[model samples]
Target: MREVAIVAFGQSDHVRDSAQTSEVEMLMPVLHDVLRRTGLRTRDIGFTCSGSSDYLAGRAFSFTMALDGVGAWPPISESHVETDGAWALYEAWVKLLTGEADTALVYAYGKSSPGDLREVLTRQLDPYYLAPLWPDSVALAALQAQALIDAGRTDEAELAAIADRDRTAAAAHPHAQRRGPRPAGEYVVAPLRTGDCPPIGDGAAAVILAAGDTARRLAAAQGRRPAWIRGLDHRIEAHSLGVRDLTDSPSTRLAAERAGVFRRPVDTAELHAPFTSQEVVLRDALALDDTVRINPSGGAQAANPVMATGLIRLGEAADRIQRGDSDRALAHATSGPCLQQNLVAVLEGEA
Candidate 1:
């Protein structure tokens, strides 16, 4: 396989809400930052892929407005996904692998505050059986938490510890939505509490990927180190909640192996675990231990803008490599209920 590396990455400040700004307005500055960092303009990109949902904006073709942020007056080759920005990166990787494009731009954004975010998320479930019940995301996650406790895999204190560690790490992230000292306390829903939940927030992010000679050229021109993608893979598990084991994330385990997560001891990991309990499941499935620094960017517990959360994981993991923070890292993203769909990527500085 041809090597593909992330040459540049940029993200906007994650806010509780962008009162006066539209998604396009929020994206424009970050897009400009990406170009500035890479020493490349819109014209230099060979392919563009974006991840955002129409439901986020409560309107169809919401991504069209975001195109304005890219300055598409002359038009550019582009595609989009209804999934997280990580999926867009997956699409971009495929484009590069096909020899169709050497350089690609991937981005995602969401303003979940405009509507009932939890209620909206239920739409992601099975329309026939799951959707009719209208179970909110946290309630489903609570079920997972309860199952873990029942199975003796973990307890409430462990969930609190996960929350404490992630939010404590967020102290270093200027873009994090929630960061402060907290006493790990009682459960908001029997064994899960406010601290165990990620705050609802609005955010956007963009990343630039280049492969082979083009990647080298871009790195040289920008005087920036590149985070090479050592391996990337994703997997999906059975959707029926009752049919699958909630305590284990089989998809994540498979995806991690396929992504070569164990090839070289990972120094750090950025996991997209929105709820505190989900982090436990992911950590166990990925076999990450104390040696692996988890969520240095504070992770989803800090700022989770739905579709944008996964891409943020990739960007943050790359940032550590670009900044010379670590030699090897893993970036993981999860979607659907009880971690139904998952992606894992092993990254390192170009050797």
Candidate 2:
């Protein structure tokens, strides 16, 4: 397979609401920023892929409207996913590997402010059973949190600590919506405090991917290190919430293994665990020990942009490697309710 690396990443300052902005408006600056970091223009990109949920926009083919910011006037190879931006990155990775593209631009965004964000997420549930129940994101997460508590995996205090650590770590990330530790607020749902849940926010993120020699060249031009894609894979659990184990994530474990997460020690990990309690399940599943620095960018718990949160995880991990802060890093993204789908990507700096 052709080697690929994330040479640049950029994101907007996440906020509770971007009421005045359109999707194109929110995306333009981020797209400009990522391209500026790499000194590349839209026409220079060989392949372009984006991720966004039509449900979030409350319209069909919403991604196409967002493409106006991409400057597709000249025409180019492009695609999109109706999920998280990290999945778009996955597609771009495949394109590079196939030698169909030497460089790719991947981006994703979410404008969750316009609707009942919690209720909007419930759209992903089973249309037959779960959808009818209308278990909003936090409620479903609370159930998982309760199960973990019952299984003796973790309790409220530990979940609180996870929230504190992730948000505190974000103090240095200017783009993070929630920076610095805050009190674990009152429960939004039983066993899940307000702090335990991710902030409903709107934001956008973008990344530039280049293959092999092209990857090295892009980084060199920017005077940065390339966060090489050492391995990458994604796996999904059973769709039925009843049959799946809420206290564990077998799919994440399998994806991590397939992505070569265990080939060697990873110095840093950026997980897309939107809820604090989910972090417990993920930590156990990915086998991330105490030694691994997790969520230095505050994770989804700190700055969840819905469709863009997962991509930010990969970007945060890659940024560490690019800055020589980490020799090896792990990036993970999850979609669907209660982490139903998981994608794992391992990154490493050059020799």
Candidate 3:
């Protein structure tokens, strides 16, 4: 595979609602900002990809409408996914590896406030067994949290501590929807408190990638370091939550191994764990220790925008390396209910 690096990242301010802003309106500035930061124009990009959901938009081909924001007038090679933006990044990386594109742009957004997000998420589950039950996203996650508690792997207090730490860290992120730690309270769902859950929000994130020499030149011209992609891999588990071990993330473990996460010590990790319990599962799956900082941007629990949350994890991890704050970092993204799918990427800065 050809070497690829993240050259620029941009995000919209996360909020519970964007009452007046259309999806294109929400995306335009973010798309422009990333291009501006990279000192590149839309025409310079060899490929463009995006991630979004029709369910969230309450319309089909919602991503097609977003193309207007990118100025598709001149016509650009683009593709989109129904999954998280991180997966879209994966697709762009593959294009680079094939030598089809030297530079690619990836972005994802979620305007979840327009509809019932819980009900919308249920559409992704098995229609016969899970969808008919309408368990909602939080309830499904609560089941996993309960299983972890019952197995003695974690407890409510520990979960609360994780929330406290993440929310506190979010206080520094201007784009985060929720910030400041509060005491964990009575369960929203058994064994899961409000703090244990992510704040539902509307947001967007974009990342720019360049392969090999293009990456080096871009970094030099921008006077910034590039987060080189050393390893990237993804894995999936059984779709049925009942058949899987809720407390252990075998898929995440496998992806981490394939992504070479344990090859060297990492200074930081930005995990797309929407819930506190999920964070615990990921930390163990990745074999990260106390020495490694986790979720310095507060993670999804602080501000989750569904499709965009996972990509934000990649952006946050890369930002740390680009800023010279860390030499090695790990970014994780997840999809499907109860952590059924996971993507892991290891990034390193120039020595």
lDDT: worst 10-residue window of model 1: 180-189
lDDT of each: 0.88, 0.93, 0.92
Q: Candidate 2 at 45: error in angstroms? A: 0.6
Q: How would the candidate models be sorted by TM-score, starting from the highest?
A: 2, 3, 1
TM-scores of the candidates are 0.97, 0.99, 0.98
Model 2 score (lDDT): 0.93
Ranking by lDDT: 2, 3, 1
Which residue segments of model 2 deviate by more than 4 Å? none
| Residue clash pairs of candidate 1 | none
Query: Which window of 10 residues has the lowest lDDT sum in candidate 3?
Result: 182-191
- lDDT per residue (tens digit) for residues 77-191 in model 1: 8999998999999999989988899899999998888988888999999999999999888888989999999999899878888888888898878888888547765565666
lDDT of 3 by residue, 1-351 (tens): 789999889999999999899999999999999899888899999999999999998999888889998878778899999999999999999999899999999999999999999889999999998899898898999999999999998998899999999999999989989989987877888878888989988999999999998988887777889899998999999877889999999999899999899888899999998889999899999999999999999999778998999999999998888888989999999998889899999999987
lDDT of 1 at 32: 89
Q: How many backbone clashes can be found in candidate 2? A: 0
User: Mind sharing the TM-score for model 3?
Assistant: 0.98
